[model samples]
Target: MRGVVMHAPGDVRTEELEMPVILEPTDAIIRVTATCICGSDLWPYRGAEAIRAGGQRMGHEYIGVVESVGGEVARIRPGDHVVGSFVASDNTCEICAAGYQSRCVHQVMMGSVGTQAQYARIPLADGTLVVTPGELPADLIPSLLAASDVLGTGWFAAVAAEAGPGKTVAVVGDGAVGLLGVLAAKQLGAERVIAMSRHADRQALARRFGATDIVTERGEEGAARIKELTGGLGAHSTIEAVGTQESMEQAIRATRAGGHVGFVGVSHDVALDGAEVFFSSVHLHGGPAPVRRFLPELVDLIFQRRIDPGAVFDLTLSIEDAAEGYRAMDERRATKVLLTTD
Candidate 1:
């Protein structure tokens, strides 16, 4: 089997590797049909996140047909087409029971599963995998794949932000998750959805996703724009999808007092001023999204053709071209890149 390995910063290669097999009672093996590069994967590629283990395996989002299941696995069986959460969680855990599957005590981050390959092992199969209804249209594959990560993450951000009727929501960042955040806000019934994006292409998608306004400004100017649009009250809720210090602060400052800020970006070099947060009177919450919690509903939406979040995938490449996919995203030439086993 061939899999993506990050040898070092700016160096990712798809090379032949040992195939995976069930090593746990709760494990299942799947032949990957589709996988993709994630922005967080860039952290190591760009040297922003340290690769403590050299030649670390890459990728977490994937969808495929189950090839085998462990003795303990039930509900998911061979030949079922399934989408997995980025985090492999035992849904019955206390943490997962509290709606935070990402922090499940018995969870496994699928980045190590190396979904960017021919076949991979999925632990906690019953809790982590959601089978799509019957056979899906070829075109719907990408959208269902998005539900494995970005779309679900974005939806979690919206829920964390308390987006709902009568609420004014603002989203900071214009990446795939950010774009989906706009979509989630609208679906959640936000009265006004503001997308802070400088890119024309992203702005267009944001609009199509129901962004009521687009603010191209940055830092304080961006915060001011949110305030102006909300009549000096800022937004009732703000979604921070870019994890940078600036973006985090901008998100905090863009929310009205008593509002909430949900940050879904993979944090790199971020430090918050406690006093600033105290004075802002804004509530903050977000971490790795509990994608498993929302997978069922999102899968239903995609299966019903009610939403097409796959539009965020601007580039599709063969698994062998993983490096190019990374480069396209790094160079800002693609919004999101999808990889196919074929």
Candidate 2:
């Protein structure tokens, strides 16, 4: 099998690797059909996050066919086409039962397992894998793959922000997740969606995703613009899809009093001012999205062709060319990159 390995910052390679097998009763193995690069992966690639001693495996989002399942696995069987959450959870634990599978007691971070490969192991198979209605059409594969991570995360952001009918929603960040957040907000019944982006292409896509307005200004200016658009009261809900000091602050400052702010960006060196948040009078809720909680509904939406979240993948490359995909994203030439295993 071949997989992606990051030898150091700015150095990602595709190389032959060992095949995965079920090592636990809750484990299952799958032949990866599709996988992609994530914005979070850039943290290590750009040296913002430290790499392990030797190197680290990359990728967490995946959709594939089950090759085998452990003895304890039920519900998911071999030959099943499945999509799973980036974080594997038993789904039977207290936290999981409460709809926070991302923090499941027996959670396994799939990034360490590396789904960007020919085959990979999935833990908590019965709880982590969601079988599609039947065999999937090739045309729907990209969207289904998006449901495994980005789309689910974005949807979670929208839900956490309390986007609903008659409410004005603002999204901070124009990346794939942020763009999809716009879509989620609209789907959740937000009356008005504001997308903050400087890129014309992203702005266009944001509009296509139901963004009624675009604000190019960032940071404080961007927050001010959001408030201005909402008649100085700010948005009823704000989605913070970028995890940074500026983005976080902007999101909080852009929401009206008693509003909600859903933040899903992988936080990196973000420090919040106590006084600012104390006076903001907004509800803040978000973390690594509990994607497992929404997989079924999202998959249904994809099957119905109700949402084309896959449009975010403007660039596609063979798995062997993943390095270029990373470069394209880092250079702002692509909104999202899909790495086809086939």
- Tens digits of per-residue lDDT, candidate 1, 1-342, equal 998989999999999989899999899999999999999998888998877576888899999999999999988999999999999999998899999999999989999778999899999999999998976578998998899999999999999999999999999999999999999999999999999999999999999989999999999999999999999999999999999999999999999999999999988789999999999999999999999999999999888888889999999999999999999999999999999987
RMSD of 1: 0.8
| Weakest ten-residue segment in model 1 by summed lDDT | 48-57
**What 10-residue stretch in candidate 2 is worst by lDDT?**
49-58
Q: List the residue pairs that clash in candidate 1.
A: none
Q: Which one is best on lDDT?
A: 2
User: Over the full model, what C-alpha lDDT does candidate 1 score relative to the true structure?
Assistant: 0.94
The residue-level lDDT of candidate 2 at 128 comes to 96
Candidate 2 lDDT by residue in tens digits, 1-342: 988999998999999998998899889999999999999999999999988778788999999999999999978999999999999999999999999999999999999899988899999999999999999899898899999899999999999999999999999999999999999999999999999999999999999999999999999999999999999999999999999999999999999999999999999999989999999999999999999999999999999999999989999899999899889988889988998898
